[model samples]
Target chain A: MRVDYRPRRVSSAIAVLAAAGSVAALATVSEQYLAVGISLAGVLVLAFGAAVYRRGLRVLGVPIALVGVAVGFAGFGVGVSLVGVYDRSFTYTGELIGLLGLPFIALGVLPVHRRLSRRLVSLGFAFLVLGVVFTGAVNGTGPDPIPLLLGIVAAIVAWDAGEQAINLGDQLGSDARTWPAELSHSGGTAVFGGLSVGTGLVMFNADITGLPLESLLLLLGAALVLMVALYK
Target chain B: MSNATADTTTKARATNTDAATDADAATDAEVETATSSSYGQRVSTDADGDDLVVEGERRRTGRWRGIVAVALFASAVGVLANTPFLLLATVPVAAYAAYPRLTGSPSATLAVERVIDDDTPDRGDDVEVTVRITNTGRWPLTDVRFVDGVPPMLAVREGSPRHATFLWPGTTTEFSYTVGAEYGRHQFDPVTALLRDVSGGTELEAEVDCDPATVLTCTDAVPEVPLRKQTRHSTGRLVTDDGGAGIEFHRTREYQKGDPMSRIDWKRYAKTGQLTTVEFREERAATIVLLVDARPSAYRASAEGEPHGLAYNLAGAEQLLTALGETRDYVGLAAIGREFCWLAAGVGLEHELTARELLATHPVLSTVPPDEDPTDPDEQAAELRKRLSGDAQVVLLSPLGDEYITSLALSLEASGHPVTVVSPDVTSDATVGSRLAGVDRENRISSLRQAEIPVVDWTVDEPLGTTIVNSTEVMD
Candidate 1:
């Protein structure tokens, strides 16, 4: 509860963004049969949100655009990466999340006001982080997927917060002036992922120090996330 | 406020043609330009009895003209070429045609406000010029150009009219220029731009509609040196001051019986009216031909980060005439660079106006090369000296730049005319180069002093006015 609001916000934004990216990548993993619908939904949602930011109106259009685009690639990359590891239905979940994620991003861009946006942003952040922690507990440390998930979430928070706060002075957008918020809610994905892997390694293996490996990897992820959000 | 601004800009371009027509050759030049859309509407507006707003814009006209020309040409070429590429070109053509209607300078969006004009500069003073421009446009701009226009007579070759800046939408930029002062008018010309496309093909030319009639004027004041310094006479000014009436103390003359009671210096009369009353010597100055020596040898060192010494002398002379313009003094400005520069002295507003016109003006070719045995003013002054002797004062503003001119100053002083040498001294103990230059400057300075001429040894480091006030106070 006492955790810095800005950091938490960054963590949440990054978590959501990372989750969406993961979902986007996984959308096609459902293989051709299930991939199309989920991918299309995600891309359509994203584009519609951007459209709204540009033209101002119609939140639904972005989801439609995100779905079309995300699905258009159709489970190809995901199928190649995951093979048969994940259940095909995961793509549907990924699709649904991306769809939901689009509106939040658009709203983030457009600003629906404090009460609604804050609740949704915070709640979403909690779910992703919890999911990462739970995954880490189950999995043996080092390279645990849970920390990876959390890092993505943290990255999203950093970028979204930047978009929300900075107008770049010359344009209508103001997320972060030059850097992502120090709190880096979006970085939550990287943190959760790192912690999960780190703790899992400690829990399972006694010889290696989870602290160094987890910290180093997570630090690397955090740096990468900050660059993505700020360099542009 | 927006409406007021638009209206003012419109009015500036809409000067009365008839009034302009009656003006002299100067007005003739204006009349020729008056026919342009930028002007000539004042007479029509008054004649029509129409109270309609004068609508005009800086960018709109340019855009529309280009758009119209391009659209018509593109359409014709599209039909003639009958190719898909030409058809593709049609999109750019259409964009051009639509741009004038859709994209504009958004007079209301961007702003050119809070214009602050410095006090009128004398002929020689350097005045600060500041202009603030804001971007009220929708897009981000990488470069903005600000052009500050002065009267044609004052245009010099060395400076630029534009200073570059960047402005994002809603961001403001301020531009400034510092140039030597001259006479006549200096106006704020409308802003213009060549905006590059994101794709980098077509350039969007935008011009802001603004008032160009804004006038900046400066007069000259008489050169104030010490009492020992003599004044030189020029054919340009009429120097004799008769007893019309003035404030400066004149002289004690035999008292006439019916002299006005007011003419009697009460304090002096109280002591001795029987002896006579004080007649304020008719306070007047001769037309002073300012002959500045601007050769390479005459070049003097300036304080760090400042212009050369000769520049200060030039500015000083201009200011003197501008101040003198305020009084009854007639002042003419002359300079001896490679060639002798001359300004005829005149009276009242005309004299001040002429000096201002000259100070801000620079000769197209400033250097007097050694090979070119140019006609020096000292030689010319010698000829004019005999006729104008006992009449005009010659104020020479120089870096004392060279030896020949230094001797020229002495010779002029020896010629029975009061001469004031304004030396924008370039020598300094502070300069390493000066240390090696061997009191060359000191010797020249002393030589001018030996002639018993009043010398205003000005440094670019300190203001000429400080030296002037100090020197003149001793004389007074």
Candidate 2:
């Protein structure tokens, strides 16, 4: 009775797809060849780490994937020197390469740790928020909101799907036939992401130029309501 | 050994095409509850039969915590930075956080039926267990996860017992796994279902009983168990000290006038003037009692998947019964466990069947270890001694894992009943604790042997018959 608790195939597929989509969207918005190259290298390292993990060195593989994340972040720092930090495109590139590392970090922690802790997922999510804050630091009319918005949604989906995959892995193990549950969860997240993008696009196009405070307060109130709903 | 017949009455009816259509028609009138109003309540109160038992409260699995944190963080950052895009992304994350509250806990109206390929398998044979789960509720169960309760004695050889899947109403799902069977009667436990609502947020735990209550009975043909030299007065095979009319010669004496002609020593009469009568050893039946030590300590095993020491003890006890049954000897069975089990010394076909059934199904000789210490060993010994016939020899089957059993054997031998010990060795050098336990057990066996008890030190890896034969030679 060998117990193998590796994440299922479908959820992992959805995670990688969502992560790659996020990186591609950010790279295209940034319009930098260096951003694409750095993101590709990060993804390749992540793939290598995943292969190593599949070979049964589960403990060793997580650190290797985490190293890949470190390399991606380090690559972004080095790119900032060559590409210039003040420009809006440089910030987008930084955000792109940084966001590219999120899924691997999620993948690295999920199967190996086997606890119900949310630290790893939260860490990746925090990185997404930090990237958005960094992009806003440049503040040059929000860098064509559509791709940026889609990139954010995709990153969130990637983390959510990764967490769900690991949850299934803990409960059922990798050998169980968990495709239906995994696919259903991923499908629900994708649908919500699509609807969010649609609603976000509509709001962007509405073009109400005044009353920014009211809008901000309204968003904060909605967030407070959601939090209360969850706790209740 | 026999297969317990699968009870077809407990099997859920397979929904046919007509039934599916009727269910579909009934679906429209039954307001679709894929939403928040039915979140906490059991959806199918109308479901009859009450086979599935749902227990425990709605436990929050904390699966949505990360997503909710992300939603809150994104909203806070977006509001402060005035970035509408990041704020917009919060909408979807918030939706996911709310998804759990918007869904109802599945009815958990699942019918679980298990079918064993071979209910009465031979020792060490692979037995396949197929489990079929059918959703009899109206709503589709989106995130159904369960792990079948495999018998503790059997180890799974192929496939996994854990499964997660979605089941639509009237649909059935099946999964099968193989387990290597061991000696004894093993009953499968109920399947544990961890049912989560459509969103993996809220979970309801339940136990689902399988139809037929699958039980695997694996038994071996009785092996030869050699007894001590003690014997009863009845005529049988064991040679006793008293000289009488038998095949083996004992001595010669002066012939009496009334002695039968066949008993007279003709050769001695021809050699000498004085006539002598030849005396032979008397053969008589021995009454034997097989006592199994099934205390908690005897439930130890050398390895994780190996059968425990008590299992070996029960096997040895069964062998002794069958072997003694073949002779004219009166044989009985007894065990010291959670309960004291005893059968009076008897010799008949019906008695043998009763003894065998007791070995197979007695709670005292259960395959699983008792949670608490059994009743006092002294009390059980007194009860056993009271029941044993005066001339009956006791064959004690024990693992000799602890001091109490060794003391018990010595006490029985100290009494009028001659005792022979068959100790099954389940010790290994796998860990420091196991090694120490092995040393302790070795000391116990040596101390028992010091009391002049004929002990068969049977290593579990080999057949008990060979060990008994080897020990019998040593005893002789």
Top candidate (TM-score): 2
DockQ of each: 0.02, 0.44
Query: In model 1, what lDDT does residue B270 have?
Result: 68
* lDDT per residue (tens digit) for residues B1-476 in model 2: 11110111111121001111233434323323311232212233343225335454668877776666767777777667776666665666677677777776666678777778888998788998888888987888888888987775578899988888888998988888899876655667678888887667788888876433456777655456676778888888888888887889998888878888898888877888678888899898888888899888889888875778887887777667767778899987788878778877889877776676666555677676888867787888888888888898889888888888888888888887888888889899999999999999888878878988888999876667778888888887
lDDT of 1 at A118: 45
For model 2, residues A1-232, the per-residue Cα lDDT tens digits are 7666766667766765676566566554343446545644665576677678878887887677777666655555555555564555556555655453554444444443555324555565566555654553344255476666666777777777777777787778777888888787777667767876787677667763235868778757877885887777
Q: What TM-score goes with each of the models?
A: 0.38, 0.70
lDDT score of residue B229 within candidate 1: 24
Question: Candidate 2, after superposition: displacement of residue A87 in Å?
Answer: 1.3
For residues B431-452, write the lDDT of model 1, one tens digit per residue.
Answer: 6777554377667777777777
In model 2, which runs have C-alpha deviations exceeding 4 angstroms? A21-86, A97-174, A188-232, B1-60, B66-68, B82-88, B112-129, B146-155, B178-193, B202-209, B213-222, B226-301, B304-426, B452-458
Q: Per-prediction TM-score of chain B?
A: 0.50, 0.69
> What's the fnat for candidate 2, on a 0 to 1 scale?
0.46
Q: Rate the local accuracy (lDDT) of all candidates.
A: 0.44, 0.70
User: Model 1 - which docking category?
Assistant: incorrect
